[model samples]
Target: MQHIRALSAAKETRLTISVITFDLDNTLWDVEPPLIKAEYAQQQWLLQHRPGAVDAFDHEALLAFKTSVWRRHPALAHHVSDMRTQMLYELQIAGGYSEEESRSGAKEAFEAFLVERHKVVLYEDALDVLKRLAQRYILGALTNGNADIYKTDAAEYFEFAFSAESIGTSKPHPAMFKAALQKTGMTAKQIIHVGDDPDHDVQGARDIGMHTVWVNAQRKPWPSGNKPDREIVNLRQLPEAINHIADAR
Candidate 1:
């Protein structure tokens, strides 16, 4: 809370908020199913194409290998797509494939994963609240992941979207929040960033002077001791919660 400032009201707070930034992954939809399905698809591709990839690399082994890769290359942490691609590419190379074959297979394999990755099933109330909020405020998406709005058919709601890859930094980093401010031509005080993550969304935005709403869709407790301006059990409550925040200012 040391980084947080008093939420002074802007003139625009009398009407609509200057902007509303959203977290993509767990906030709007469940991310795990598509990701799991995508990974399974990738393994299937490997088994069908490669000789011994299935036996040599089962689910447990592949997960461990990915973890080790991420730990080894801290620089690529911001760009998960690149990390996944590079990991598969290197694994194929290690499996005796030529550089061209490995590169092609890796690229193809990632694209296969991406198809299911973007097949996100939004929460029952996510779209409703987003549409309601979008009518009154500027909407932007800020995420640490690489889910494309066009792929998810979410482009209509968001004025713009930024990810860790696009921002050249991840959430919980000052740079990501700074970039949002830069793009919107608004001060942090003028916007409210809503997300599920206590650290990345609440802490990061509040640290930079923005008001925050903790979308605790999971019913998790506030573990960090830093409180968000508002907390709601679901996005259905978001519109009312935001109104309360706006009125308080």
Candidate 2:
């Protein structure tokens, strides 16, 4: 790896990280609660605006509607906003709504969910660690989700937020990682990708020659023999773990 200035106090012979890319969903925040809330938000909106659909399509029927939408528009699977909108529109149509009515109603329903979705509850120390790391290294976000970095207080600390819609694909795909490097003008070795996923965050960036830090919040077992360069149980440990990686260089 090419020698670069270390961000941490610990010095290394050849520390290569200049930019740090993060995965947003479960990495910085517990996505489950907000997502569950968002779905409920959608359901509430449908209940108010399209009682017919809400009453007709129960849990199982809605699930089948979602499946059909994905089956028809497989590419939208990674684009959260579009996927939800498309699914809502399909459900509206199936509920006896006209084409124009379905489209407009779906857009409105998706907005209800989107508002709740952006109201995320970040993990403990996530913002603090990001602030500490941003002082020395460029910080960017790479994600498959629709979480708008601008909506969060932590937005100011991020240099950029790259997402599936912007990139036309999601993580586990090298193109997402490649896009981050190209946009930042940083070499793979000059960046470290940190996230909670083995495939999307760790393996994808690893394959591109970027160092990886797996934030294992769930404490799940590593699924493969190959492992990330570093692992941490919580966001609080990130700064020190990153420092350790730099020192190892």
Candidate 3:
């Protein structure tokens, strides 16, 4: 409210926001649950197909190994899906698989993980809200994660989708935002980016002069000095928040 009021006081003219970009993970759905399930599926596949692949490491050790893999390949950090496949391949090698066997086994294991990854449950009223918003705005999905929106229930509503893997960098970086601008041919002022992360969604968009709405479903305190133009507890409150921005002009 403080930020919204400040915008109202400072604005000289009304603004028109034609595009609304969103962060996929934690914004539309709780990502952790699906990710956990997918990881378990991947592990089970490795255990059955490539024996001892994950047997030597517990959860914490596995997580540490994943981090080590990431640290070893900084260039592929932005490409999470590729990084994961690489992790699987390396793990197979460590488990005594031949290089050729590891390559194919890694792919099959990743496929097992990916199939379960798509089974995400959207937040309540999320699809309905998207359907309503799509009528008026050019909706886009901007995510740093590997979630494929096209496989999700909200696919048809998004006019375009961009990911860190697709854009070669993650959010809080300008690459995805700039790509969105290029694709839509819309000014930053005419778009609003919404997401759960303050730094990734709010600060990143605001840095580029785009309006932002922080989806604070958890009712967390504002952790940063830079604030979003609007904040909402749920997707149900989004249209009103967007309306407030449009009308504040």
What clash count goes with each model?
Answer: 0, 0, 0
**lDDT of candidate 3 over 19-119, digit per residue (tens):** 88999999999999999999889989988989988898888998898898999999998998899999999998988889999999989999999988889
The global Cα lDDT (0 to 1) of model 1 is 0.82
- The C-alpha stretches of model 3 lying farther than 4 A from their native spots are 1-14
Clash count for candidate 2 is 0
lDDT of 1 at 7: 18
lDDT of 1 by residue, 68-174 (tens): 88888899999999999988887887688889988988998888888888999888878778887776677888999988765665667787788999878998998
Give per-residue CA lDDT, model 2, range 1-249, as digits (tens). Answer: 121223322223234567889999989888889899998998899989887886687689778877888899988877878988888887888889999988999999999998999999878788898888888788889999999877887897887789988888889899889987776666788788999989999999999999999999889999995799999999899888888877887
- Best-to-worst lDDT order: 3, 2, 1
> Highest TM-score: which candidate?
3
Residue pairs in candidate 2 whose N, alpha carbon or C atoms collide under 3 angstroms: none
Error of 1 at 203 (Å): 0.3
